[model samples]
Target: MKKERCDAASGVESIELDATVVATIRFKAVPPQLLEVDIALCDAAAAGQVDMYNSTPLFVAATGGCTGAVDTLLKHGAEISCSVLYETCHYGQAEAVAILLDHGAKVFANTGQQNPMCAAARPGSVKILELLHECGFDINPSDQGMISTPLHEASEIGYVAVVEWLLTHGANVDATDGAGKTSLHHAVNRRHSDVVTSLLDHGAQADIQDTVRSYRASRGKYDIVQLLLANVSNTQRNLTVTS
Candidate 1:
């Protein structure tokens, strides 16, 4: 029986649970010794200490650890976790991601509820998205950020392919952000016609309005009147029109 770490305990409190209970929190914070030792490994790799990332658990040949020290870690047998790799990959580090995958990092490692697939869409990296998919990532994971899915992130950022991939992968097309504004709401507010169209094609609510009045005012260009007319249900539309 193993217990996942919790913030409630002041110190290291261990619990015993069956594998299912332990399954969710797989990647606990590594020990300080490992972090320090891994730094040396990363430094060595950065200096070309390793030929390629190829080791189980990837502590060896991981060129990416702590972002800045990626190249260094690869030399000493340090494979980066999937989330960090995807994040850097989103920033266009194709070689870095390739190395991590080569070294046997799990593409499905959902890092703290933020999946690598979400990271790929955040930066609008089509290459990163493709690579992660090729490696078998869940394109439409339910994990979200502040009430937003990866599709919402891509739509908000005007990432066309990201939005497309998410829709194709079965992302909830009408998914709302923390603000309760749907993807279409974000696109229209941001004036991204392409994103707006993409979202609409996938059945995003056209008339979803910002519950926050201030947010609506912030987007002076958005026509709250027209949006309400087009997207609301006939019953609601009639009521609003009559009122």
Candidate 2:
């Protein structure tokens, strides 16, 4: 009987299932093809050196965007712990994310990356973000880490499309992260002109609307603040001209 990896003796994490099997799973292999890797869907951690994820075959499948393999693993009770969903979102595997969600995966994963929303934002996965919203994820989850919301993450990386989508879906345009910086602040600091424009379209960007907050900028580049004030001036001028 081919036992699942979870059946291994208590707390053993080193690769139980062969790395080759995991590699196969990572490269888009599905069902019957997955037959050789143990039907039990092991919980073995195939550390980075070997499988590059230090996670289970399920996680490997998720990161690889192998939807069928992920479904197979979930059917066998593979653990969808924090890391699993987080890694899946980080990789922008929407189909796999849907599978995990259907399998009772948590909407807001609290992995090393904090929220899966941030992970998806890093890659500009708007489809995955939509899936997250459908599953009831908070559009503006408070940044318990580097970014306050997915919008901040998108703007920080200059994911212009993602920034626009997040705004349309109710993310606070002026929301701040732990650094007390809004999406506009991040966009301005990162020189993401397109993202700056997107944020301006949403609402007030703290460009000069009485925001008592800190700035995440180098002392040498305090000029970025001036640039923001200058942008606000341009916007006001445009608005006046249009009126």
Candidate 3:
């Protein structure tokens, strides 16, 4: 009998398993209210689940300008020093940013790729920039790695108001990026005539050359090229008269 049992066990295949012996799997249906309670009880559980881009629920809420959600997460002890701060700035969520800052988020914190100030520049909102400045961040913080100044970002995107605000805050108009390109170079290259004008009004050097091209010859925008040339000539004439 023992020999016969051993032979039967050896002959059993995966597909030959008895249906009655197989484990049954089932999901219990819960009421919506109960599900909500369960989620609330385990709210901390999903807080650490990151998406493919490594963003958490708080990051999503902050980036979407959801101040209420941000507040709730902060109350739940979510981390305040993550990229969500930069996301708030990037999306122009001034209120969300303020909430994060009030909870001890660093104004100049770098989120691996860009800092809050750099993110704010992309939206070109003077209000956001002012908030960051009021929080004690340097208006002219030195560039790190490949990151450019806020002025460079604002100029490149043609944000006249933001450019003006940065200039008023004493941002270096001639501050260069990794390639030695100044804000004037960015504005002219992107054909933002108004931004280029603003930079020149703020004393951006018209003759500064980047690694590959001078500000005047950086782009095919005729008006920008003409503006740079005229500004350069005027600067030279003023210097000659002074001398």
Candidate 4:
């Protein structure tokens, strides 16, 4: 997961540099003062001077891995629901995810544009997907003001594993968006062939043209045109032979 910013660079120290540390370092284009803070925290951790619950240390550790500061915060007690605490989870910070979970971070707490489960699905992280499920996130909860479900997002983004996981967990294959279009509509419109195949295999309707067809036709897949036509031809043949 990508780190939005490094809290460790703010004159605090954390324990155990993890992915977030790498992320911060990679973003060296940031201001030198900000860079100094991260260096100080990393230095303190290396020197064993940083303690947990210092917001900087906590944010660093919460964004990834088991740092001494993180452990200290947990041992001495810290608010897991801190507003800034959501960044690590939003970026798909797995190790930090585990640490936060151990520290009782609210898994159900909404983060980003959606819940962590949905956010994880966007990145197609199977580990995060499984964790969110284990944490009791609904696989097909009501879309959070989006036109579609998590399946729709995953399929549109070509995240086959996420689409498969959500389906196996009872995500409706034909679940519709606000415009009454299914995941198939999203996959086809996005030209995600794999997602289209997956949705079809799971029984997504092939001919679900909605009101926006005129506007979306340029993007809608022609390959799916063949599939829909084939189904029609087969059905017509069967009807004529029977008649």
Candidate 5:
């Protein structure tokens, strides 16, 4: 009897059920009716299967952005926490995230291996970002350790809206990551001209160099290099006049 594996990407595991049975319970394919039946038959059947990395029914449903499935699972006593929230944020499932939050899920749930705010930043959904903020997600949390703030992620990915929102909400424009690279450094490295411009407008320090390498020397994005240099020169001139 070969042990059946749940979706490897989901990191779920199941008992040695038949492959067909496992297939019927997949996150994408399982209808609400079938999910109810499966859960009733084996509430502890790992929902999709218990993997080292994946949680149960809630995590699986959230990952798929199946809001209906998530509702059903939550009603069935699925623990709402960071794991589920992180998955929904990663998939950009705003509706699922809303439902979870309505059901008393913690916005700052201990993100096991995922950062919920950081994940939200990548997709540039202002609504979700605002919702997380309303629920007490720090706009500039340093808990990410070496990963830096949501602003850094947004800037690196060229999410101008998210970057703007973070700045408006008090995210430190010059916060550095474990690599000592600020959001400006990331925006400059990626050559996201619009993001670089927005960061500068929001008071990001253009002259701050990263510990690993110089932004001006590493990439030859002439426009971006010129923009950074121009900002630095303007600031220096202002200081000289003030002195």
Candidate 6:
């Protein structure tokens, strides 16, 4: 679904833009002057020229970590679409994301790139999430009609570092998506023991009932019910001691 939505930014403008320019950027070429020669190419599409499946020159440069092209394009008035940020996150390009944000790129949730924070979390780097945070993107980005917070994405994919980072950075451990299931529920269903432990340690409600989906233990190696009960016991003991 994410790939489909992100790919929606794709289209080609062969007459207005140079194929050589797109190729150079795609292959890691970084001379900014190649762009200066053709200022028309910078914002050829008004919205932002995209080729190779709807990628902007700025976005291509950022994706490949080519700072020069990124700078040149932005200076020439390239569109600062959130789609660029989304691609940078999806590609794990932290510096590129910072460049876009520095150029005043805001996450327009209504765009095709609906959930940039989700893309950041999907890449398994807390740094990208941190960059977005600088842009005022909270731990849980506001829903754009799509389900799953960044926490849910990381939890389902079993990225414990991402899960922990979100929890520390202001994620609601008990927050549910449109599906009415918390990140904890996702982890349990996906059988990510490490992620489940991280969520529980972060004070997720272990006793919260699962109303969306249920799963049976396929193998004895990991027991969901046992894990939840164990956390519940530890929580009660901690409360009693502190009381």
Q: In TM-score terms, which candidate is top?
A: 5
For 61-118, candidate 1 gives per-residue lDDT tens digits of 2223333234444544444555456456556565656656665655445545566676
Put down candidate 3 lDDT per residue, 23-141, tens digits, no spaces.
Answer: 11001144434323332322343444455555665676577665666676677667765467776888999888888888888644433445577778888777777777777767676
Q: After superposition, how far is residue 108 of candidate 5 from its true place, in Å?
A: 2.8
Candidate 6 lDDT, 1-243, residue by residue in tens: 001112234564322454555655566455555543443344434226565666766777787776665776787678776667777888888877878888887655334446778888888989988877777776675446467788998998999999998898889888898878888888887888788889988988876645112324314434665667576656554553354
Q: 228, model 3: CA deviation in Å?
A: 1.7
Candidate with better lDDT, 4 vs 6: 6
The TM-scores, one per candidate, come to: 0.59, 0.69, 0.71, 0.61, 0.75, 0.72
Candidate 5: residue pairs that collide: 13-49, 13-50, 13-51
lDDT of 4 by residue, 1-243 (tens): 222334445644343444445445344455545544544444333323233333354554555443444555555444555332335655666766666666776554544334556566666777766766776666676456565677877987899888988888888888887777778777767777677677777877664444123224425566754554443346553443354
Q: What is the C-alpha lDDT of each candidate?
A: 0.55, 0.67, 0.65, 0.58, 0.69, 0.69
- For all the candidates, what are their Cα RMSDs to the real structure? 12.9, 7.9, 13.1, 9.2, 7.5, 9.3
lDDT of 3 at 183: 85
Question: How well does candidate 1 score on lDDT at residue 198?
Answer: 75
User: Which residue ranges in model 5 land beyond 4 Å of their true spot?
Assistant: 1-24, 27-53, 107-114, 143-146, 211-213, 217-220, 234-243
**lDDT for each residue of candidate 2 in 1-243, tens digit (9 for 90 to 100):** 222333346654323456666665566465655543443444424222145456567777677776766776677557677668877888888899889888887645443346778778988999888887787777777645555788888988899999888888888887778866677777766766667667766774544433212223424445544444455666654443354
**Clash tally, candidates in order:** 21, 2, 0, 4, 3, 3
* Model 1 misplaced regions, further than 4 Å: 1-75, 142-147, 207-228, 239-243
lDDT of candidate model 2 versus the reference: 0.67
Model 5 residue 208 CA deviation in Å: 1.5
